[model samples]
Target: MAGVELLTGRAGASASALALETAATRHPGALTRIALIGNPNSGKTSLFNQLTGLNQKVGNFPGVTVDRKTGVSQLTPQLRAEIIDLPGTYSLYPKSLDEKVITDLLYDRGSAQYPDFVVITADASNLRRNLLLFTQLADLGLPAVLALNMMDVAEQHGVHIDIAALQQELGVPIIPMNARKGIGIAALKIVMAQMLGAPTVHFYEPEDELLPMIRQIRYYFNLHNDYLALHYAHQYRHIGFLSPDDRAYIQELTEKYGFEPTARQAQETIDRYTLINHILLNAVEVTRTERNEPYSNRLDRVLTHKVWGYLIFFAVLFLLFQAVFAWASYPMELIDEGVAWINSLIQTNFNGPLVSLLTEGVLAGLGGVLIFIPQIALLFAFIAVLEETGYMARVTFMMDRIMRKFGLNGKSVVPLISGVACAVPAIMSARTIENWKDRIITIFVTPLMSCSARIPVYTVLIGLVVPDVPVLGIFNLRGVALMGLYLLGFFAAILSAWAMKFLLKTTERSYFIMEFPVYRWPRWKNVGLTIVEKVKTFVFQAGKVILAISILLWVLATYGPPGKQEGAEQQVRTERQRLEQAQPAATHTPTENTFADETERLVASAKLENSYAGMFGHVLEPVIRPLGFDWKIGIALITSFAAREVFVGTISTIYSVGQDATQQTVQQKLSAERDEQGNPFFTPARAMSLLVFYVFAMQCMSTLAATYRETKGWKWPLLQLIYMTGLAYVSSLLVYQAMV
Candidate 1:
């Protein structure tokens, strides 16, 4: 306790002084490292954004794909700080992947993220439950601040805390602020700046009975403190860095000492709660004020109703789809025009295969991907609004009962919701579902959700069949079609989950516990950032795959086996000449009967059909033909396995190269395409068939790889790929045959 000294006994100043002392003693860098910790719904993300603005990015913690958001915050003019927003957790005891990341980072002295200071955020309205995490972090004795977020909601509840008394009892600066309103931020920064060079202090300790065992662990690990050693003692077996030898020794010592970590954790929680309740007796006051039950609770009555709730959700989804079609039309058209212009410009400048590569491969690929941006942006924007308003939690609550019927736990809703963004992260999020069977089932079916990756594919194909006409005088029928595709996916996921549920069995009980926050107006700033971040991630991440595949496809389409292209133009000209001459002189004029442009396109097609990728496509054509796919589409199917988003780019590259240099867009080129018999290649039946095919196909390798990592075996991902592919083939076949 040498580094700790109260600035004023039972007063407010000691909290600031302690932080300052801790920083002075231990602040080791020019940029003070601050770690943000909080419970779910405490507005930690909002606070992080307020602190760092757009200067933040999401990255993976070392060796784990769990997202770690880090950013730089200028706490004050004098203090520069780096902030890491740790995932929310209730305690140091790990239950999920995210929780494990926190426990591992905080307890490991060797970690770069083992912070010099911590900012523990809590919801003022749910102070009792939120404080459980705050008290646990305080025990680590790092220089820390307690931010009572959402003060407005607390005021509405007639809840008040004596900030001075809480500061004295908790021995941390108590900053009561509404993160959404930016209230108290300046004062919090000023206090944080003052504590930039403070020393760390021990504010909480274990019982005398456990101190002996903690000391032994500290000595054995050569650790700096008892808190770190105690964590190691409890979780040695699960600790990634601990050797088998280390785990064996810890196991032996714990058994010999008759130490029970679970029992110890239970006792600690009770003792801490007792201490906390006593402190609150002096530090907090509650009126038990009578007010209308929270709006969230009232709204949940209608929103979570068994029948009406579902109808409302579908209505919302239909509205979302209609917006995608309505709002995105103008922008999508502009994108198509821009791409056509670029393709025309590039095609005019270059010659031979090089011209095709630039115009057809690169520019066309770019055009296909960019056209979907508006639709993607709109989709995520609506989702963001839903999330910010807390409607999504209600969706989760309603869906939980349905999930239980499918062998999934309530927590599966998180992964399924996340899957809409991207399946890779969604599968990673599934780690939070503790039951092995439930987590595996969630992972298997998450990709079936209509991810943003599928937006381009769906919009492109759906437009071929579903017109943009308004339905019921207000809604876009095309949007209804899009929603139908999504519903198809959802139902497919449910059925898949049911099948897997019957196949995989576990002995552990399933449970779902969650707290819902009172509804608030959407934070527009956060909503904009959410959409921007999601769209940016999509463009850049998908761009890499598209670019690589486009280049490879260009090479495959441009080059052929020796002499393959030789006489191809001559052969096309010979056929056109014979046909033109055979027609009566009175039948047509020279220009009218000419097929020069068509002949050039035919030659290009013939050469491509014999080229490397085309030859491979021909090999796949027979396999995929029953699903209404030709050789060109077969090539796209093969490349789409790398990423489902690549389908548009693949089609763009394939069609653009074989097409005449007529400055047409990819969609126009596709629409104008014909079968060998001169019928439209993409009839409504074929379009619907392909759309159904993509909806069920497990086309992304990354999702499969993520599943492998999550399940620690290939069995699940392999089964997933097979099941989805089979479903896709059979569904597409039936649709195409019935429609034809």
Candidate 2:
């Protein structure tokens, strides 16, 4: 028996790889653009990394928000090439947004980023199914090399391929590669650098019943190849090159030729496979030996077991949250102390009304955003490890049964879990789901899950409510509480999804079919890069919002009705004079005294009360008082709309103005806050109420922007905002009233 290749079979591999010893290798300067295209999990990215390491940029496609990655590969050190890595697609026939993005990028010859050549990656183990995409690319008449990746896995399963024979049959150079181990990467680079920008050659000349209509479209559209024209007939609705009139013309032809989309796609797929099978018969061989199921299967059997799978997943989550608190605390403290030093330095050197803005508005706002980097990085690191090691797929598989009940496919699980890091990208990730309703529902509820932006809010309030005592002598009570917050989000998402199912009506059928890649050791480089990139992106993106809003808020907090500031100053002066005069001669101390400290505090407090921002907060106080919020909390709540974590910066700036802005930490100032009655403002009941409020509220502008982009309308984003805000209000009201 031959070695097994999934979706097909393999026995062993034998061939002399291209060494690039040919005189054609000339390293003069930069080479032209080459696109790396492949099916999902085909190791194309790994090969790209092998070609270009640490020299990549992440941006968006023109006029679209899809992620685009381009890196430079040093083919021969001097013969460098710009490699564009397109998103993974199952086929050129677009079923999802990502697939549409790939097609738009490659098919538009007018675009600047169009590739001169392409490298089509096919998984050797899954050769039959992977070939479907390769065949489509070949039909476009772009010169391409086929990289059969994961050859080690194929050989291990006793799958054998005659590489030279397959190369001849396909009418293209074939390279066997194991990207994970850097096998045959040099050979791939040689072939890519050699043949790029040369004449366009195709591997397959597909014959179809639709040829007559295709020829008509080609003549009308002036297309280069019959298949290119045929694809216009196949997916003109999504092809960006086609205009409304063009699509209408294609539609007319479709009816004229009796073209059926499903039937044609099925026939083309079968024909391609039939053609591929013929090539495989003489070019491939398989020899099977006595071997039990692979180790990954054995692990999946236990890890994805009905009973144990759920339990193990929860246990992993528990440890993840617990570690966030433990590991991030040290860095957070350092950041806090550093901010305090900067605040003190500004007070000593700078004077006047603007001094407070620099210290509280800029430095404090930046600190608030930066302080959470450790926690954010840790969360993303865990997520990356799970993803890189292939455990995340299993998690999705385990959650699918439940996801279906809520009108979502297992694919929703990835986006929902990623929401814990940040909702903007999480909602963007939902585009992977083929169904619009599922994607929209996932976007609506993803914010309900506490993102990294909410961590500062949750942790700050948790300090005021939950103790740091150990639970069951193992888990910290605070850690358990945080985990509970995340769990609440998951529950809310599913319940909301279930309700929305009845609201949204669509004709598109939903399906869940995914291949669970074999588990492997986590790639540490990818893990580190993910953590750094995520943390950097979060900080800088958040810093921009925090900076602009902080300055505006400072202005709001500094000025008041002209007479009010003057009156407050007079009152502070009079109080200070009275205190100084009352002090006995023997107790007099000009430099430092308790009376001085007391006087300064009173002055700051009075100034804050009379500020314009204070008046607004006071006006809104009654509205939120039922939920255990004060005037300052009211201001923070309003500003949090910029970003949930902006709540921290808003509160920091406000509290710093009212107290000793230079000395105390934001948390310390918050802890010392009092009401008119002299009771703690952040009472456990009040803190818990706020936590519940943030947990359910959609207080992120970025998330709303992404939702609008993905859904392409304001209706869904507005509805999401309204629903989440209403839920937050009622829930926080109930909790605060009950606890108080």
Candidate 3:
């Protein structure tokens, strides 16, 4: 088996392998195109990851926004293949946008995505249900192979499969596999590199009433498979590859012959299932007649109990939030030290505007964002583990009831949860919701779920106001504060949705039906990959905005109207001299060293207050005063519109412009600030107020753009902006006034 280089024990397999080898020799540079298709959650993606590893990229298909993942797999030392992971669908009949992508690409031979061969992954335990999709693709006359995935799960259930018998019956090769553990990978690659046989047994043939219509379509399109021709007749309107004239021709013929597409499609499915069942009856057998309940089922009794389920879910969330803060603290400190070291080194060894731009502007701003990577990565890792272990599906199932009360469904939970990583993609995920009203409402509220971008802001502010003391002998108070802010956002989102339920009218209703996948240990490789990709997106995307704004903010804070800065500095000096003169010469005063330090601090503050950034902040200060925000905070509020995470960078660059970079971190700089009354500037009331504002504010322009993309208009986005801003302002005002 280790030396299985060619597919044997099947008729014509040797010749197929020979032909494949010859073709490879003739065109060594060309990649053999293969597609992987299966039902949703059938281990299709796991097999894909095994086959492709890190050699993958994601993009959109030709004309649609649905993700297209393609990767190169080396079948042999010399044979390489390009693998396209198509969206999972139950069958050929399309119901949603994702399923339609498969139908369109399969029906159109000219599509760039059309594969030279297909590897249909099926769940070994649920072969009866998974085979329906495999049989449909076989009937399309494409060269195909069936990879029986999840063999471990099947074996655990006391199910036994006769691989040879099933392959003989279906007239195609079947490889038993557990994709997660990389079992049977060598055999799969061996068979994949060989020429494959199309199914000799066609599972579905057109009935007499539909044969004429299908035949006409087959002849007009010069197609070889009857099932494919039938697909065009049934799905011409939705198929993107067909021309207007082609669709019209099919439409005209359908009406002329009175072809019933709905009836014919339903019958075709029924007929195929009948064939599949008879084939499996002799090919598959159960090893156990009486056995204890499976582990997953036993666990579900407690894990999915209505009352216990919710509690367990929240408990998991609590631990996750706590871990994010506790586990990431060391790495975050290291990053902080590294950034400060680099800034100090640059400042000591260099001098000029460009050096200032690099250290004060670029380093200060980007360093603020980089220090939080540990926390962000930890958060993403937790999420990835939840998804990998199949617990996320249970969460969705548990939330369906709650979601409906607020004009949403269980499907809305996915986007809202995804918003924890990013609102842009989370809003895009709303496409899975079919009902127009449900999707719109989901998009409207997804941004309110505190995303990873806000973690930097939240952690900093929470650390300022909330002590890091142990709670209940384990929990960190800061972590508790982080959880409270997230829960607050969640509550705000649902409450807003409930209010909108009656404000907007729609007759369309939506329902959610989902499957619970058996729990498995989290795949650490997949988890690692997810963290890498998410961190990259966060750094590259947010870093760009932070760098540009950091430079701009430094300019605004470092220099003002030529005469104004000088005048402000002179005024500070003049006041100091007047104070000295008023003091008795004999009165004890500060030593020369202490006096110089105080004078420098006073002069820096005076100049900054009159700089361009300060002038602009002063304008916004009056409006934000009710919320306990001062001029510097007002500047941050305005600059953060570009992105919420920029608030930290803006603060860093502003504080570092005229200060010693080596002496203090952003938190220390802020902690040492004072107001006119000589009170700590970032008091608990003001810190909490700012946190509340950010939790509700529509500060990310990317989210607004994503909303427009999802809703296809400014109508909803504009309303979202206005209502969210108003909500943030009012909420911040209330929190500040009450706390003060």
Assess every candidate by TM-score: 0.81, 0.81, 0.79
* Model 3 steric clash pairs: none
For residues 75-175, could you state the per-residue lDDT of candidate 1 as single tens digits?
76656788999988888887766677787787766665668778889888778878778777766656677788998888888788777777777766678
Please identify model 1 stretches exceeding 4 Å from their true place.
1-30, 196-204, 407-488, 500-511, 588-594, 621-695, 698-723, 730-740
Candidate 3 lDDT over residue span 465-579, tens digit each: 7887989999988888899999999999999888877787865445465778899998898888767765765566545655666677788878888799999889879987786
Q: After superposition, how far is residue 623 of candidate 3 from its true place, in Å?
A: 5.8
How far off is model 3, as Cα RMSD? Answer: 5.9
lDDT of 1: 0.75
Residue 278, model 1: lDDT of 84
**RMSD of every prediction:** 6.0, 6.8, 5.9
Which scores better on TM-score, 2 or 3?
2
Q: Per-residue lDDT for 282 in model 3?
A: 97
Best by lDDT: 3
What are the Cα lDDT values of the candidates?
0.75, 0.76, 0.79
Regions of model 2 farther than 4 Å from truth: 1-31, 197-209, 350-357, 409-440, 450-490, 502-510, 540-542, 560-563, 575-592, 625-632, 639-692, 698-722, 733-740
TM-score of 3: 0.79
Give the range of the ten consecutive residues with the poorest summed lDDT in model 1: 1-10
